[model samples]
Target: MGITIFEDSYRHKGLRRKLIEELRRKGIRDERVLNAFDKVPRHLFMDSSFVEFAYQDKAFPIAAGQTISQPYTVAFMTELLNIKPLDKVFEVGTGSGYQTAILSELGAKVYTIERQKDLFQSCQHLLKMLGYNPLYFFGDGYLGKPSYAPYDKIIVTAGAPEIPKDLIAQLAIGGRMVIPIGTSDLQVMTTLDRISPTQVDIHEHGNFVFVPMLKGTNNR
Candidate 1:
């Protein structure tokens, strides 16, 4: 479903504030991430039926059989990347475009990819209408976007069976990538810091669940 509602009421702001406090209690300490959350109206990214619950720290179903990542999950992954202003960030999934907006709020030059055509189009439209300017791609994210290679940071929003090498190759030396790797049911959130062209530092953050990252685009 496309985002049809644009109004963010006082109640919505109040609810979002509560959600941010909840995230803080959950140990999300990055003030920048919190401020971004405070600015973006997440309800605008959600379908109308779920808009009322948009501020909750939970994931909800969107179109194309995909689920938006929970607010805490979004904050966690984003905070891990430690995005710098104007950092070129390559995002693996553009589902809902909520994360993309958050990245834009952080002043990242975002290059986001979505394998699902429906999501790619809808997210692109909504973000444009909302004033975000991320470069959007409708293709297999596994291949990454080589045209804009050597990104300062990479974030894969889905659970991948394994880290795609192409994405790693696209990362600039000293770049960091946050991806969830494991089976379909569970994934360990992992970070790869490319210290050099041939070397990386790997660390596991924790376990989280996400929709599986697919191989190719889905036109339907």
Candidate 2:
């Protein structure tokens, strides 16, 4: 893969710091999550046209029909996952690789899937250039990654019509899965904690908007 060069200057760092403060004021109390945001250069993950607003706590369009999730949403989901160092995290969408970098920054061994071939390839290159080493695959997010089962935490970054049973099955007992389930326009942020082999504790956070989680891979 060819290296994509982007500069991260002091101005960008200042902007990120401000963004973190904004997130904190918005009730995101996880220091680790904030720290991850502090480290990753959000502008570097965005297109040149959108880079100026990268730290604005909003979503921006990416290569696929997907958006790089808003900073608040990303922080909220990461906080929900309660990530720990070396924890195995299964991520459902690898859009722009921004969230993937955050997971890496929080010290998780991330295995992420993206169905859009263009996004999968570009994000893989960008993550590698940024020195993130997450295992990335181009496949269906609904199917999850069974070859590396029993993840410590699973995070789905797209809106799903229903909770994917296959993904739930891939969660380790005692593991947590954060997903957005509802219609295409809006979704309730829900978390499933697997307490036993067949029992899961469900909790719903607020609603958020995301691209629909589609089936199968876009090999083109």
Candidate 3:
């Protein structure tokens, strides 16, 4: 795989500012989340072919049948997590690493996993080039990173048929998780706040679309 070259120019920053305003208008009130959108160069995470639409509030296809999620979706989910600086975050479906960069920007120590090897490697390289350091792993997202259990927060980027029990088990007491759950065609954005050792408060936010979260790793 050749190195994907990207430039973060002044024009890109201006577009990002506009994107932030659009997100605010869409009801994303978290200041930190908005600041992250301002800091990360969204265009750097997209293929050069779709660079023009990078700052748009829309999803774009990436490698391995995945997508860089719409900006509002990212902000909505990130806001649900209510991330605190230096919080330990476990992320499923690293995809384009754009969301991972946002988590890192908000001062979360993110541990992200990806099942597709191509996306895993490419996203790792791009994130490094952009200087956003988050621990990366290639594995099945259905099985949350057990070795690093008790995460303060967890975010799943893909749409799941149901919430994975292992993910809930991995959350620390009083931890939070943001995931999209429902069918492959459409999903409801849900937030699970672990209130006790055995209790979690689940809240449904709204509807969104995302790639299906597959069960196992794709070595191909």
Top-lDDT candidate index: 1
Predicted candidate 2 versus true structure: per-residue lDDT over 97-135, tens digit per residue: 999999999999999999999989998777887899999
lDDT, candidates in the order shown: 0.95, 0.93, 0.93
Q: What value does the lDDT take at residue 90 in candidate 1?
A: 98
**Candidate 2 residue runs with Cα over 4 Å from true position:** 1-4
lDDT of 1 at 83: 96
TM-scores, all candidates, are 0.97, 0.97, 0.97
Q: Model 3: per-residue lDDT, tens digit, 1-220? A: 3443566788999999999999999999999899999999999888899999999999999998788999999999999999999999999999989999999999999999999999998888788888889999999999999999899999999999999999999999989999999999999999999999888999999999999999989987
Sorted on lDDT, best first, the list reads 1, 2, 3
Score candidate 2 by lDDT.
Answer: 0.93
lDDT of 3 at 171: 96
Count backbone clashes in candidate 2.
0
Can you write out model 1's per-residue Cα lDDT over 159-205, one digit (the tens) per residue?
A: 99998999999999999999999999999999999999899999999
What's model 1's lDDT at 85? 100
